[model samples]
Target: MDTLTSTSANTWPIISNIIGWTYFLSWSCSFYPQTILNFKRKSVQGLSIDFLYYNVFGFLCYSIFNLAFFFSEDVQDEYRRRHQDSDNLVRANDVLFAVHAFLISFLTLSQTFIFKSDQKLSVTAKTFLLTFIVFILTAIGAVFTEYIKWIDVLYFLSYIKLLISFIKYIPQLWMNYRRKSTIGWSIHNILLDLSGGILSVAQLVLDAAISGDWSGITGDPVKFGLGFVAIVFDLLFMSQHYIFYRERYDFYLAVDDSERQALLPTEQS
Candidate 1:
């Protein structure tokens, strides 16, 4: 069993590598367009805030978890005689770190431009901003992690931010579930999120099992568990969309038109 455990840890790199890139490609190619469309429309009119907020939070937590895993390893290696610079785990971490950095960049960029008006930024311009923010932040975080004693606090902030962000979504979830419609939901986004959540939990469990650390496997299981539960809810949310996908109704970009129609029924009717 011990050998098996060690072998599993050794194999984690390959598994994680495959899973991580799969998510990256899927999100980049499939889900990103929906967000871009929503931006063009300037209405999250049919998009679910609960889902988006939860995802942002989840990414933050995952980022922190990744950082902690690295920190713990650095501590462990410090006690050894001569540390090998090219360990498999180190290489895996590097890959994961880059992946997460990209995730954060894309997300933040999406948030910034996806909610903005068309006049504000061209598609190419938004892409540039996303790339810039992602690069700058990833570089800064990497540097800080290596040189600063207080950097662990940044990881702590990431965890806390996730929790707060997740909590902010509860009301939105309840309201949407009660209404039985995704009046403000984006199906593709939620679908991708559900996939991401499953991958995240799987990665966490694999890491925990390999390391023999139940705590690390489950980061603040209460918070983590809630996030997982939220992901499941997201799946259900997407189901709601699937059941109603063929229904045709206008999702407006603004409320002004609706209000005007109400006030002057004779003008158009």
Candidate 2:
């Protein structure tokens, strides 16, 4: 079998690995700030629930899909193992799936509660009803396992949700770009996003070089185009915040000290 390779073949993997690691670390490091903000604010006041809701749903879908894919891979691995086929590939896939799935699942699930806490009663009521319906549908599909391919439905929903998320972010990106500021943006997230963007483009380029087409990197140019633009502007936004609007980034620290100070009433007294 011949694989058309890129000069970036070895480099791309290292880059991709680095990108993934940075993403994971960024999110992990950011958790404390976001958690403290929500805790002290007692609200998700300035956050966009639309972003959180779609992401949470998407992560839930991805987690479920990961389990399904892992099971399938395990079955294939078991058969191959008996036949003395290479176990290395299977092991690699298992580790990859476990890491990606667990990180996404944990982040989404944890953030969901934080956002939920901040939602208004009316908003919360609506979200709960919608989530309940999705759960019920998913449960019914689980019950009729063979006939109902609930995972597929969830995957489709996730796809749609990501589409909607991009759409939502588009206007925000444009508005921010035009204004040349990221007034209310999260610097940590923007920084992570900027890095993710470059890595994503590299991944796409590498994939295209390998396959001689843009098949696996992303679905199509339209989707890829949207992602590209979003990422580019996100980098710009992050740069603006880092260079010009450093004060807002302190929103994270302020939340932390406020919480700390609250806990020690005698210190003020």
Number of the top TM-score candidate: 1
Global CA lDDT computed for model 1: 0.49
Extract clashing residue pairs from model 1: 46-184, 46-185, 47-184, 47-185, 48-185
* TM-scores for all predictions: 0.53, 0.51
Could you give candidate 2's per-residue lDDT for residues 103-221 as a string of tens digits? Answer: 65355436547556444324643564377458657765774877545434433543543454354454445544454445334566666555545544554554455445434343323
**C-alpha lDDT score of every prediction, in listed order:** 0.49, 0.47
Error of 2 at 29 (Å): 4.7
The per-prediction tally of clashing pairs is 5, 0
List ranges where model 1 is wrong by over 4 Å.
1-12, 24-34, 40-42, 46-152, 174-180, 218-230, 243-246, 253-269
Best by lDDT: 1
Listed per candidate, the RMSD to the true structure in angstroms reads 9.2, 8.9
